[model samples]
Target: MEDYLEKIYELMHEKGYARVSDIASSLDVQPSSVTKMLQKLDENHYVTYEKYRGILLTARGQRLGKLMKERHHMLEEFLRMLGVSEETIHKDVEGIEHHVSPHTLQCLQALVLFFDDHPESLNDLHAYTEQFEMGSPTDTEGKSV
Candidate 1:
């Protein structure tokens, strides 16, 4: 449902409208599925749905969708700033945005903005991670310290 809201909000801005087919294609689902979800969203007061007409989000729906999109965009930018591979970044962001709390997301957004402003700090972090990539030094008994 969040995914549908996010995509619809995105398409609304990008294309000035969203259709069941467009959402189905974007989500890789069938139009029938999109229709069902849209009805649910409508019932929940998140969207105004009328068959063969257009869908428009209510205030609450718009807020939630905008938040979802921002969270997704922020995670992607944060992962990219950390030098994450493009292939790995998208999946990671999707997995993360759904699970992370609003507070944690804010923290991550702060970190991303900080790194963007102070790229030298990000370079330092990359340099620091190199040690872990090679292998963490273990203490006695083969335990990592």
Candidate 2:
């Protein structure tokens, strides 16, 4: 449901409306599958769906979609900071976004803000990572030797 809402939100932003075929293509699913989901969403009041017409998100759906998009962006940024490859960031964010708890997400959000506010810290971490990868010795306390 969240995925559907998120895709619909993206389509609406990019194309001004979300047709069932558009959602199907975006999600790489069949139009029949999208229609079934849209029917469910309409029943749940998440979307206003009409046959042969585009869908409109309800307020509740819109809020959830915005939140899901933001969460995905935050996770992608954090993964990039960790030197994850672009493909991996995209794949991992999708898998991780749905599973993250509120508390964990808050921590990740803080980490992102910290890195943004203190770029020197990110640089230091990267430098430390390079040294560790090069077989630099470290003490029991994890400081470089």
Candidate 3:
């Protein structure tokens, strides 16, 4: 349901409207599935839908969609900062965005801000991660292995 809202929001934002076929293709689902989800979204007051017509997001849906998009981007950026692969970042963000709490997200946002304000810290993070990956972890006192 959330995925449907996000995709529909993206399509509507980009193309000014969302079609069942376009949503289906973007989500890799059947048109029938898109229709079912759209009906559900309509029921939930998230979208206004009619057969053979365009889909429009209600204000409620728009808010959630925008939030989901922002969360997705933030998670991606966070993972990218960790040197995560693009493919992994995409997969991980999808999983993490739905499960993260608002508080945790705020904390993550703060962490991102911290890194932005202290770029040397990010470099240190990278170096620390590389050391661990190389199987030379630091000791309790932060001494090199």
TM-scores of all candidate predictions against the true structure = 0.88, 0.90, 0.91
Q: Write the number of the candidate with greater lDDT, choosing between 1 and 2.
A: 1
TM-score of 2: 0.90
**Of the pair 1 and 2, which is ahead by TM-score?**
2
Measured by lDDT, the strongest candidate is: 1
Model 1: pairs clashing at backbone N, Cα or C within 3 Å: none
Q: Write the per-residue lDDT of candidate 1 for residues 17-125, one digit (tens) a residue.
A: 9999999999999999999999999999999999899899899899999998998999999988877999999889878988989899999999999998999999878
Q: How far is 64's C-alpha from truth in model 2 (Å)?
A: 0.6
Q: How should the candidates be ordered by lDDT, best one leading?
A: 1, 3, 2
Q: Model 3 segments beyond 4 Å from truth?
A: 139-145
Weakest 10 consecutive residues of candidate 3 by summed lDDT: 67-76
Which residue pairs clash in candidate 3? none
User: Candidate 2 overall Cα lDDT vs. reference?
Assistant: 0.89
Q: CA lDDT of 62 in candidate 1?
A: 94
**Candidate 1, which segments miss by more than 4 Å at Cα?**
137-145
Which residues of candidate 2, in runs, are more than 4 Å off? 136-145
